[model samples]
Target: MTRLTAALVILGLVILVTWALWQRSTAAEARADLAEQRLAESQQREAQHQMIIDSLWDNARRQANQRRALAKQQAALTRIASNRLATIEELQRENQALRAWAGTRLPDAVIRLRKRPAVTGAGAYHQSVRDPQPLQPARE
Candidate 1:
């Protein structure tokens, strides 16, 4: 081959190698950009998931606190009822008249009230207690 032909062939090979390297570099950059986008999306999804978990946890904590408060209230009510019953029994033991009253059966209206289903609120309880309807006979 002539010197000029050899030089031309060498130059063409150099250009081809440079073009291949540039294409590979561009492909690597594209892959890097895609990886970064995927990472950002994953982080956002994780943040949303964490938010849901935190909300659930807060709700659970609130329910537990309410349960504890209700339990304390129930204990206090039970103590008060027991004390009142004890006082009534002591007074009955000390007086003949009181013993006779304690021995008597509850009134029909009071018995019917005790047998009914529990009401929800204070207003509902008051309404139920004050209702003027006659009591229904108990089923056999």
Candidate 2:
């Protein structure tokens, strides 16, 4: 009976030790699983953050390129406008010189007729008879 009791007590101690070992292993596995999950979540957040930063940098580069192109186009347009203004001024000067030359070259009688206001119907025939010469084109 003493041997049987001692054997039972030893068997109970072995079972308790086994249960404690199992609990400790299970707890360790749970802790490792939690740490692994946390590591995966951190990696996922870092990937997402890196993607956002890369996208922002691309957008900034595109905007800078767009701004540079716009500035170049504006400068070209400004130069074109300035050149056009100079051309217009030159045309105006040429028109003034042509008018002055025309006044000097025209016959006095034709000039006087041009200065007179148009007279309607019955008076138009009298005016036409006074200037019977065929009109001539201006010399270039």
Candidate 3:
């Protein structure tokens, strides 16, 4: 009877140890799975962050290029405007010189004749037939 009881007790102890080992193994596996899930989530978040940064960099680069192009266009326009201003100043000087030369060369009588108002229609036709009167010099 004692031997039988001892054998039963030993068997029960063995079963309990096996059950404890199985529980421990299952708990360890659960912890490992949780860690793996957390790692995957962290990796995904990093990828998203990296993508956002890349997009921002690209936008900044494009804007900088546009600004550079705009500055270049403005510089070109300024250069053209300066060149046109120089040409206009030269033309004005030339016009003044020509006016001075023409004033000296043309006779006063001829200038007066050029300044006279034109008579139109019947009046103009009659004036052309009559002896023309000498035009009076204009007062400044």
Candidate 4:
């Protein structure tokens, strides 16, 4: 083949190879961009999941603290009640009049008060606590 013709063929082959390399570079860049986008999305999802987990942990911690506080309060109240009962029993033992009074039947009003269902909530407690008759008027 003529040198000029061989050179033209070589130049064409060079152009073809350069074009193919450019196409491959662009494709690689597109894949890299897509990978970066997917990575960003995954990181966002992970962050949201971590936030939810942290919130749940915080809530659990708060509830545990509340339960501990409630248990401590209950223990204190139980101790107070026991002490009061002991004092009353001691007094009852020491005094014949008090023992006789304790043995007497409770008043109907007192029995009704004791038998009433426990009230719940602020509104209900307020309503329940209001005395219908603060004091019995002196009989005419």
> Which candidate tops lDDT?
1
- In candidate 3, which residue ranges exceed 4 Å CA deviation? 97-140
Best by TM-score: 4
lDDT of 2 by residue, 1-140 (tens): 99999999999999999999999999999999999999999999999999999999999999999999999999999999999988877776889875566457667657766866576777786876676564555565
Q: Where is model 1 poorest over a 10-residue stretch in terms of lDDT? A: 131-140
- Provide backbone clash counts, one per model: 0, 0, 0, 0
lDDT of each: 0.92, 0.86, 0.86, 0.90
Best of the two (1, 4) by lDDT: 1
* lDDT at residue 118 of model 1 (Cα atoms): 82
Q: Assess candidate 4 and give its TM-score to the true structure.
A: 0.73
- Checking candidate 1 for backbone clashes, the offending pairs are none
- For model 3, residues 1-140, the per-residue Cα lDDT tens digits are 99999999999999999999999999999999999999999999999999999999999999999999999999999999999988877776889875566457566777767766676789876775573667557667
Candidate 3, after superposition: displacement of residue 80 in Å? 1.3
Candidate 2: residue 13 lDDT (0-100): 100
For each candidate in turn, the TM-score is: 0.70, 0.63, 0.63, 0.73
lDDT of 4 at 139: 60
RMSD of 2: 17.8
Clash pairs, candidate 4, are none
Clashes in model 3: which pairs?
none
- Give per-residue lDDT, candidate 2, residue 20: 100
Candidate 2 local accuracy as lDDT?
A: 0.86
Q: Predictions ranked by TM-score, top down?
A: 4, 1, 3, 2
